[model samples]
Target: MTATPGTLVLAGTPIGDLADAPPRLATELASADVVAAEDTRRLHRLTQALGVRPAGRVVSYFEGNETARTPELVEALAGGARVLLVTDAGMPSVSDPGYRLVAAAVERDIKVTAVPGPSAVLTALALSGLPVDRFCFEGFPPRKAGERLSRLKEVAGERRTLVYFEAPHRLDDTLAAMAEVFGPDRRAAVCRELTKTYEEIKRGPLGDLAVWAADGVRGEITVVVEGAPDPTPGDLDAGELVRRVRVREEAGERRKEAIAAVAAQAGLPKREVFDAVVAAKNAAHGAPSEGKGLT
Candidate 1:
């Protein structure tokens, strides 16, 4: 009889509280034939805390070694070994490892599944008090200010609530940059040490949060920012549209691109914005304002 192929199980570990580790997680940890973890040391601690002895051959599987280890893990799976993949916290392949291995397993026709558990992204979003009905998880901003700002600029106009993971040390600067790009008045929440004893959620305008974080915070941090507000018809006036276009231009957007962005934000056509600019220029130059023009 042909033996059934093995399965790849991506289990979610507790983000903080040990009790959050589901019974299925424990069972999977104890029964899998091969267990791969981001940090074997952390895995050992988790197993000890849960009083579970993994009956599998434990191996290290993290970002640095994932590429090299994936093929090996896939081979084990092909040999009918049930492979359990876990990260230090939360679900794997989410800003973590296990994605490459899972992709490899799928290519070989091996079954792949996940054990749902606590997610910091969802946790922060829920507590953020922002609109969670529609949201996007942007895991970790770039460490460098320039790259980070460039990244932020790309999402400045996103209407869906935005979520991001940030290092405590960089929290202040990141918030400040966010305030600069997304606007100081933009509402946001900074959730730190989530699900832990000292868990704290700071909610306020980005500018205020930047000032507060200047003192420094500690622990796993997740930030959720409210989406840009919908533009009302009154906001599309020529002068308002011009100001919006200027804001984009100041952010390094090309004139044409800025006009398009302004038009989208104001719910106006690009031609309308172009005409507004031309008319404003003509009025300033004491030229005809309403005749057939460039736009």
Candidate 2:
């Protein structure tokens, strides 16, 4: 007879305050047969803080060795080992490690569960004062300036509130890029060191935030920016509509979907945006006007 596969627990660690740790986290940690941690040293601190010693072996499972370590963890889980996975902060696999291990365990028919706990994303969003009804969590912007700007441009017309994580060193540059791409007057909030002693939430326009960050900021940062304003049909000219469609296409979006998205943003019918794109294509080819059906 085959042994039952052990469970895989994805535990959420506090972003800053140790008190934010969930009650179940300690129980799971103490009972787990194997504990995979992003940083072993941090794990030691956390276990000490909770005053609960892990009953099983602890191993490092971070980005550096996530790929190599995933198979090993899965094998242990297959052998009926209750494995607990934890990151330094927040939940694992949200711009962190543990995705590989979770996926592998699931593929092997192992039970995978999560311990609901603190999240910097939700915490920052709630404190942002921006629209929490609709939002998107954009993990982190690219490191390179050109790539970062390109990434920002792709979502320049996003209607949902945007959230992003940024390193302290790059916060200024990132905000500057956002000011340029999303416009200087766009309202935004910068959450620093959430739930920690030095926690700060700066709310202002993108331009102001950029200027403030120029002087320097510290701690883990989460930025929340207001969504793009919905423009009326008359607000966007045919050339601008075509340009928006082209931008989306360049960003790997299907032309049809791109046209529909631009139409929604401009609050116009999809047919209108499709016509504009068709007209622009014909004009670029120097072709005479011929009524073309929307594809």
What are the lDDT scores of the predictions, listed in order?
A: 0.90, 0.93
Candidate 1 error regions (>4 Å): 1-3, 232-266, 270-295
Cα lDDT tens digits for candidate 1, 1-295: 7567899999999999988997899999989999999999999999998899999899999999999999999989998999999999999998999789988998999999989998999999999999999999889999999999988877776789999999999999999999999999999999999999999999999999999999989999999999988877555578767766766778798878888877777777788888887778688899976646332
Model 1 error, position 15 (Å) = 0.7
Clashing pairs in 1: none
Taking all chains together, the TM-score of candidate 1 against the true structure is 0.82
Candidate 1 lDDT (Cα, 0 to 1): 0.90
For candidate 2, the per-residue lDDT at 279 reads 80
Any idea what lDDT model 2 has? Answer: 0.93
In candidate 2, position 265 carries an lDDT of 91
Which RMSD does model 1 reach against the true structure? 5.8
TM-score of each: 0.82, 0.93
Cα deviation of 92, candidate 1, in Å: 0.3
